[model samples]
Target chain A: MKIENIKKEFPIFNNKVQNNDLVYLDSANSSQKPLVVVDRIYDFYTKEFSNVGRSVHYLAVAATNLYENTRSAVQKYINAKHKNEIVFTKGATEAINLVANTFGQKYLKEGDEILLTELEHHSNYVPWHYLRKNKGIKINFAEIDEHGDISLEDIEKQITNRTKIIAITHLSNVTGAILPIKEITELAHSKGIPVLVDGCQSAPHMKMNMQDLDCDFYAISCHKMYGPTGLGVLYAKKKWLDDLPPYQGGGGMINEVKKDDISFGELPNKFEAGTMATAQVIAFNESINFLNKIGVENLVKHENDLLNYGEELLRKNNSVKLIGNPRKKGAVLSFTIDGIHPHDIATILDEDGVAIRAGHHCCQILHDKLGLTASARASLGVYNSKDDLDKLNESINNCKKIFNK
Target chain B: MNLKELYQEIILDHGKNPRNLGKFDNFNKDAKGHNPLCGDKVHLFLKLDENKKVNDISFEGEGCAISMASASIMTDLMKGKSEKDAKEIIEKFLDMIKEKDDIDTKLLEEDEKTKLMSLGGVKNYPMRVKCATLSWHALSSALEDFQKEVTTE
Candidate 1:
């Protein structure tokens, strides 16, 4: 694929933001949808819409197949062993909550600890906190190093006999630190602790194989994958799917509904209760196709190039101070400018049609550790290039000039 | 909508070197305000005398230029004003940022009104309206003696 012309695949890039070409560098928050994904959504809603897995009608059966096709596509993409391991949820936040609720009910007890890292987004940490509040479980944090990276030793240091499970982010959203999931999972398994990898950041930028990582559970955000919003994929080991109770009680999740007793359905359906985002699930097949066309390896190289260029440019600017210097980083450039707040930087950047995210980026614990209330982040996606970084650098200079720094 | 108007010289000056900063030792009424969306925080301290007039007002917080300047300018104008006058001014300022195009000129002096109106540019940026008004709301909560922390969700 011609990576330079990839922005043409997204309709959003065709228009101007504030009379200037949109320099969208906020993909760490949510990626812009490609033309293929958007078209799939429209096509499904207009010509081939139906409630899936409900009726034996031709449209219903076809819709059901399309929905399940996404499951198999996700299974194949992530290399999960079983197709049934992929369960759909509202988003990654709901996916993590499902595990915390079901696993907390089945496994956790009073005084049990759920070890998380300081780099986790609220989606990874807040769900476990619910268990801490209700189940009397303790939550321990694996501290980040000076470079904002969490090592295997950091996870090992927090583990105890009472540690029930270890949940960590595959990539830090704030510091862009990529965790060694395969190694961390191996160490957790040695101590009989299950590891849950929050792959919201990693899934869009790297190659993921369930067997290679060996993590018990992985949560994916579809919106960040150039897929439709209101859809997420939860990849769990089938053993846990069978052992844990259903997350929600509603239609399509139960094998037989009875007044006194009920039997839940099998595998993914048991966890996916009620009517799902049928159109989103169907459209997400296009997202997988989009990623497959370019290939994740190509995407990684392109984004890494942008990251390196943006990092070098920002580092050369004396007023700009980057948050972390992790040895292994992703496509995120988070920084603070001297004599300027992040909000001001964001406003000034937006004036030049440079769209970046400001504030803690939903990683408050990490921000607290960095001793900053907020910082500005310019994260990249497949469509971004060095030109966008140049715009960002120019905007930073404008912000510094405005503040007389 | 214009960046130049939104970030005027006065706003930047106050943001860089905020006036009436730091907690007051004799503060009697105080309240902390938080903008959970952006993580901006303001702790306002007020010392109302026996006549219910603001003898001294100060604040300490971390926020964007708009917020810090808003708080700094607010504290500068609030000193020596009656509690009733402080509440009225806060209401007017918030009204201007939220919906009203201009703040009532009678509420403040010409220089003070211009400083407060400098923040009026925030009205165009809907996402940042909270940044400009977070401290003013904190002052309102302090005057009312609200026990809970004020939040701009």
Candidate 2:
């Protein structure tokens, strides 16, 4: 696809805010929705809209098909062994919580460890904190290298004989470094520990084949892949799904509701208890199509080029201090100017119609380890280009001039 | 850019070379406030006068320039004000940040509140509201401890 045509897909790209183009650099936070994904949702509500998995009426049947079709699409996208292995969730945050509660607490015990990396987001961190309250589970953190990449050497140190689970992010949202998940999973499996891979940053930019990766669990959000919000995907292994009990219980997830004894339904249905987001799921399927059309591999190469260019540009400027320098990572480049604060840096960039994130970026532990107060981050997406980065470079130089840094 | 253009000349002068950025040699009252969101912290030291006014105010912290500057300005603002007036300024500062022009019309003109209320522009960015208010919150809590001590006697 031509860059211009890809840019045209998003309606927000055309928004004339402050009499300039809105250069969105916060894709790591959430991707901008394309028109097709938006319209599919609009059309679903306009035509075949109804509560799914409920009534056998025309609209309900169509709604059910749309909703179930999404499961089949996600099943193929991740190459899951079965569609039942794919559970719809609110977002990666909620999906991680469900597993930490249902899978972690149920299986883990007192003095048992939940090993994680220092590079992890707080969503993965705080859930284990809850276990300390209820289950007396111990939390252990793996060290991050100076470049902010997690190594097996650090991970190995934290994993004791008593370690039951290892939860990790596939891509560091801060440094954009990709972890060796297959190797990590193999080590975890050798110890008879289940691994949960947070694929929030990886899934949108790269191809995922869970069958090959063989992680026990993988979680992603639809909105991160240019889909609508309020929906996520949790890809669990077939064996794990068969043994683990349901996370939530209500209507639709049960096979038989009796006065005394109620029977639970099959694999995926047991996870989805309430009414599902039929239209949103269908729209989410369209996001998979959106990725498929451009091809995730091609998208990866294009983004890597941007990352290389961005790194080269920042490397020359002595005033800017780059945090992480992982050769293999996503396009999120976090840096801090010598004298200017991240807040002032972000606001100055915003005034020039270039959006960037400031502050600790929900990774306080990483900041503490880096000895940084806070750093500004500019992340790339499929729609980003060299010109967008040029704007960032120009604005950053302007920060030097304005603040005399 | 002239610092006075954005901040009051008084604020700029104080922020450039803060009154007491160093460690307090003979510190008495002390408290700490941490903004976990941005990983910014403010440790305050006070030597209260016999009349309970702030005789010496010093701060130490790791924060963004806005937070550091705000704390610097705040310590300067508290030099001679009574404890009651200082607390009122802190209250009015938060009110002004969260609800700018919508504030009670009469209170905007009040001298003590208006000094820091000039910083209400930081309210536009909701994420940054905490950055601007971190120092004020620390001062509020530190004074909380001071008040507690005064009543305890």
Candidate 3:
């Protein structure tokens, strides 16, 4: 499929938003779903609705196969060695919380450190903070450089003998800086420490290979991947999943339940407690197929072009300070106008049907480091185009005009 | 829903050069307000005299034009008012923003009423109503000697 035609695949663009075409630039927050993914959800609920991994009924068996098919697709898509390594959670927040809860239960101890970066979203940091409060674990941050990039050296410098695990973002949602995960994992492994990569910002934009990256644990947000809300994928090595205790205990995660004793199920089921997001899991197969049809390489090329164009255009505009001049950046463009607050800028931009995110973007630490209270971010997905960015620039100019800057 | 109404010139003026935009030296009462949604913050300081009159009032923080302007105008109008009257004005202002009813502006001068009315644009924008009300809530908390930090959740 042609990259320009990608917008046509998303049904949201077919309708007008407040009498204007939607110039969606908040994909890093959550991507707009394509028609295939949306229709798949409808078709599943309308025709073949049933709970998975539960019953012997016809719809139950069919739903079970469809649900597991998505698991296989995700396993192949990320190139994980084993399909059972993929466990679904509510969202990336839950996935990270699952790891923190299970890992803290078994390995982490008082005074043990978990190395993080300044660019981590609240989802990645807050889970580990719970360990700090409950398990008395200390958390250290690897500082970002002047360009907002966290280098391998930063990670190595923060590693201590007490450092048990290093959790980091593969791609920063705010600065668009892609961390050196493969190298970070290699370094962490040399010290006998595990690493968890928050792939919420990375999974949807780039190709991911769990085996190649060699990170012990990685969490992905399905909603950001244009799949659906209420679904997340946690890819852990088989060894860790087996060794770690079960996160939550309930139905479907049990092997044998007695009044006196209880045993747990195996692999993914051990982590997925209660009824799963059956329809969302089944529908997400179409999201993977949609990406496969267009191809990640083509999508990357198209987005890089848009990012570069946006960077150059905003750079030439006076009083607009673009954040993070990383050597390698993604399609995220975060900036602050000199005289206008980000909320004002966002409010003005919304009048033009330009949907961008303003504020900390859930990275309060990074915002403090950058000396900014808030920022305006224009992030791109496969469907974004240069025309959309042009409207964004125009709307920014209007915002400046309103502020009389 | 109109952007021009929300971003009126008076709001921009107040937001740019906010009045009493600093901490008080000997504030008898103070409280912090935070809007976690957008990371907007306001720290309100009050110096109430022995007669229960507001000898001085000030604030320090960062926010959007609507919020900063609201705080600036609020502090400016709150000076010299009794604590009871100040609380009443806050209640009236919050009521107006929530579109409950027209507040009794008899206690306020015509100029002060005009300045307060400039913030009425927030009534049209639901998401921004918190921005306009955050500092007022903080002021109320300060007057009542509430210990917890006020949050526009």
Candidate 4:
């Protein structure tokens, strides 16, 4: 499990992307999966496939146990107090929508405000925006500082009597700013407000503890964690899960149904309706195990070193203006070239087999605030090395040469 | 497949200093175009004379080299053409970008055909075809006075 040899685990690296080795820096969008996680999906379908929580057949029982085992693994991985607090959805967007719909249905009233930061991805903001339209709830934003970090003071300043919930990103996908989630949660709790953290960018790269951070709801994207697509995890406190109304109704999430009256199932099942992403849910356990084997601290250290190296290298390159420069940052390096648009930069970079994300990265509000239409982002992951970033720098230089910068 | 074909000297020159890259007062028709994927945008303004021929054309926005150059070249070629001729040229250019092997230069002169043919490189880059066609789409929408903004989703 040497960190340097981590790239060998991902089969993508074994092949060439357009006749060049893949310098994947788009992990913040979605991570490249390891062999174990990919194999788990194949093995589950080939050998041990069954619809979970359904029939009493032998394969069904085994599949049920394996599915629930991943739930327990997720519980322990995020250190949630209760296993039932973890609910699986299609993706992080669905997880946030579930919370917003259920919470808005039960608690949010007219004129109630949900405080979000400028760095929130559209997934985090759009779901709450539904409440603004339907329930007449107001959404407020905490502005980012010059360095693009959202401070506890900024969160506190936006809090008022009408503010009901505080939703924020754990780490900005654009700026790489890691917010003070624990302190923000503590502040919200002091004001008797709940906090929802969009951990799509944070959960894969950093350590997370539900009880430690004390956020009421945390949404995670499994694909971004080197797991399969079409699966996400929502970690909420037991009380919130217990109190919130069911998001969607179907066969699996029902306790009793009659012609006139129906009672929903309990905790995790209440949130998860119909046939879930069975193979993806089961395979995600390998993703958790993969992270555990390499260890979060090591991944954090490796990514931090890569980020610093990338920052220094890109900083030295003239006309490559790095965005944010937050005191506490993640593994994303978002920048813009002076004479070239980000799309042009990405196109040229792709010519060299370097995969980076360009455009708003789903943070249009932040981009507008920064007076930019788009930017090029090179995000890192566990498998990324300094060599990959070196390629990014070289490709950026090639882009400058092509753009006549 | 060929970056050189996509980033030709003419294309780079137009992208660097785009032609008609500003708003014009007293324009009769205007339309905005947006590429949501890349966040590139273009606002095309045009004035048609009594004979329905394009008297002036201008654009204001920012985008990639392909998009800016496409808009720049499009505006330069669109001026002085009838609305029907402009529509036909847009269709021909868009057809070339999508699937057509070559544009019908019968509607265009030799230099106009050459300038528009430079963008034929976009056909090799599937993701960027929209960038090369966005301004053309906006111009078409402006001709019809489409109420909603045109978006290359």
Candidate 5:
């Protein structure tokens, strides 16, 4: 699909929001779904619906094939070495929790440490914190510099002999700072430490290759990638999947359930418990196909243009102070108007059908570090255009006029 | 649906220059309220006298114009009223915010009722109703000596 006509692919843009054309700039919170993803979900339920992987009936067999097909597609999409390495999860939060729980069980003990950064979303940090509280593991944060970017040197400085795992974000949801995950992985591996990347933001906008980044585990949120909600992908190296224990115990993940002895199933099944999100997993294959058709390189260049256009527009506006000055950033544009609260700015902008997020964007630690309780963010996706940024500027000017600034 | 109704002149004035916006040196009851979604916070302080009458009412926090104005107007009308009367006014105000078109309270003067009704404009915006009610909930928690912090989840 061409970038210029991408907005037409999403049915939501055809409808008006509050009597105005929808200028959705909140893709970082969640991307709008295209017609193909929506139709795939409907078609699966109406025609090929089944509980997948259990029954011997024709529909069950077909549904199971459809479900496993998504795993294979995701493996190829992320360039995982083995098809069994991609595990379907409820969402990225659970994916991170799975790694934290199993890794904490097998590798960590008291006085051991997990290194993180200030830019991590709460989903990444809070799960590890459970280990800190229950198992007495410590979490050390590598602070961001004035530019809000976490450099390789910063990660190296925070690394200690006790650092067992390094869990960090591939890209910040708030500051849009793209971390040096490949180099960070190299540094951590040199010290005999494993790396888990929270790829919720990066997987949508960037080209992801598990082999190239060499991170031990990577988590993805499908809904943020224009797929259905309640479906996630966890890309773990075959080594870690083989070494770590299963996260949950249930019917599908069991190989044998003898009275006294029970054994787990194979690579991906051992981690996925209970009935999975069948329809979402099947529908996410369409999401992968959608991304593939657009081409990751084209998506990258289009979003980069939007980000630069948005940044320059907001920078020219007086009293609009942006959150970060990172040299390497993604599609997030967070800022604060000097005298206007972010909530008020959001409320005013909503009148013009300009939707943006006004909060910590689930990175409260980063907000606190920046000495702000909240900020306004305008994020981009493939469907976004320069016209949307122009409308955003006009709406901001209206907000300023209302406040008599 | 109209932005002007939601942000009238009175609300903007009060939000810009809120009255009774400081901590009390001696306070009988206090409660903190927060809207975790928007990161808005309000710390309410009350000084109740021997006869259970409000001696002073003040607040300190940061939020949007609607929230700040609601808090400012709420604090301005709550002072010098007895605890029983305060409860009645709070109920009336909350009722007006929830569904009622207007509040009729014997405790408040005609002009005070008009000031309180200005916040009713928030009824049109479902998401922002919480912004208009967070401070009032905090005030109620403070009055009843609720031991936990108030949150509009």
Candidate 6:
């Protein structure tokens, strides 16, 4: 993929921010919108805007076809066996919550273990905390080595026969470490426990095949993948999705309503409640096309090049401590200067027009494990170039000079 | 983009050679403040003279140069002033961070909001407002504890 041409696709890249060419290095947090995705959404509001699966009017028919059409497109994009197996939730958080509420309510009993790795994001961590507190389900961690690698050894150590489910992230948002999802999933499958892979970080830039991963549930956010915000896809095995109870109860999730005893609609319909983001969902098809046009493999290769270069620079600075040092990581590079706090690094870097994420990246538990409060993170996306990283490198170097040991 | 532009070299010097970095085992009052957001923390020790004047202030923490410099500055500002005026100065600093409308730092007769204009740069970036204010918050918390102990004892 041509990185410069891809930059042209994001108008935000064309405009100056803070009076400088916006060096947006914060894609792991949220991505800038491509012009095609933006225009698709705007055109829907201007031309064909209506509620999907409602009304017999032409606009409604067009909207319904467009909205549901994105489902098959996404199913094919993720390689799920059936379109009905895909449920559209608000975002990855909601997708996880849907499964948590339904599966936690039904399958998890007192003392049932839910396995998670130390590299899991807070979104993956908190919902299970709710389950553990409310349902008496036990939560256990698969150990992360000093380098932030999650091994099958720890998973096996933590998994007793009582282990009911294993929820893991496909990639670590902070360390950029890629989890062994296939091996992890296969391990869980051997014990007959379904695995839920949080693909919020991986689905955007990495190669994601629901079938090949063989995980029962894979959750993703649309905005993370160059689509609009407020939408995510939850891919589940057909039987598991069919067996799980309805998550949210409201309009459009019903087959028939009686005075008493209401029956719910089937599969994906039962999960999505109330009025959906019709235009964004319809616009999401354009995102599917966008991803298809610039293949996921090429996008990964392009981003990995940036990550590879950034890491080399990061390693040269002896004062900088790279958090979650691992054998395998994603495009995210998180570190902290020895004396300067992550907050200071973030502010100074922002002044230089280098927009990188600084904070715990919402993984507080990992920070606690590392014996630090928060670490600065520089995450890459499609449009980032060597120049963008050079800015980060320069700003960080200035910081090191000021706080020289 | 020199360090002196935002951070005076004096701040870095003070951070590198912090005055009150050592422990104060016995003190009139002590309090700890932790910024859960960035994980910066400070344990402040205050020694007051017989006339209710600050004899000295010292601290120990893991923080950025700005925060440590601000803490060192806070100690410098505290020793010469009485407890009452010291409290007022802290309030002024807090108001500066709040960055309320109609704040005039230059007009001394209008009140002591001028001390706050020193942090006007914080207005540019919303995230660092908390980082700038964390030291002030920790100082206020320490003072509040001191006040509570004085009333009871």
By summed lDDT, the worst window of 10 consecutive residues in model 1 chain A runs over A395-404
Ten-residue stretch with the least lDDT total in model 4 chain A: A339-348
Q: On residues A41-145, what C-alpha lDDT tens digit does candidate 4 reach at each position? A: 999999999999999999999999999999999999999999999999999999999999999999989989999999999999999999999999999999999
Q: Runs in model 2 with CA error above 4 Å?
A: B1-15, B23-30, B102-118, B146-153
Which pairs of residues collide in candidate 1? none
Each candidate's DockQ? 0.64, 0.37, 0.60, 0.66, 0.61, 0.51
TM-score of decoy 6: 0.93
- Cα lDDT tens digits, model 3, A1-405, are 888888999999999987889999999999999999999999999999998888999999999999999999999999999999999999999999999999999999999999999999999999999999998999999999999999999999999999999999999999999999999999899999999999999999998899999999999999999899999999999999999999999999999999999999998899999999988998899999999999999988999999999999999999999999887899799999986889888888988999999989999999999999899999999999999999999988887777888
Model 5 chain B is weakest, by summed lDDT over 10 consecutive residues, at B1-10
Q: What is the Å distance of residue B16 in model 2 from its true position?
A: 3.1
Deviating ranges (above 4 Å) for candidate 5: B8-11, B24-29, B49-51, B124-127
Residue-by-residue lDDT tens digits, candidate 5, A1-405: 898999889999999998999999999999999999999999998988999989999999999999999999999999999999999999999999999999999999999999999999999999999999999999999999999999999999999999999999999998999999999999999999999999999999999899999999999999999999999999999999999999999979989999999999987789988999999999999999999999999999999999999999999999899989887999899999987889888888888999999988888999999999899999999999999999999999988877777
When 3 and 6 are scored with DockQ, the better candidate is: 3
lDDT values for all models: 0.90, 0.81, 0.92, 0.92, 0.92, 0.79
Q: Compute the lDDT of residue A31 as modeled in candidate 2.
A: 95
Model 6: residue B138 alpha-carbon error in angstroms: 2.5
Looking at model 5, give its docking quality level: medium
**Residue-wise lDDT of candidate 1 within A118-232, one digit each (tens)?**
9999999999999989989999999999999998898899899999899999989988999999999998998899999999999999998998899999999999999999999
Question: How accurately is candidate 3 docked according to DockQ?
Answer: 0.60
Span of 10 residues, lowest total lDDT, candidate 2 chain B: B144-153
Residue B106 C-alpha lDDT in model 6:
34
Weakest ten-residue segment in model 1 chain B by summed lDDT: B3-12
Per-residue lDDT of model 6, residues A75-98, tens digit only: 999999899989998899998988
* Cα error, candidate 2, residue A64 (Å): 0.5
Interface RMSD of each: 1.4, 4.3, 1.4, 1.6, 1.8, 2.4
Worst 10 residues of 6 chain A by lDDT: A396-405
Candidate 2: tens digits of C-alpha lDDT, residues B1-153: 222234333334544576679667765677776766566677888877778788889888876556677777678778877788778767867787788563343323456344455556566766667777877777777877744211100
Candidate 6 has a DockQ of 0.51
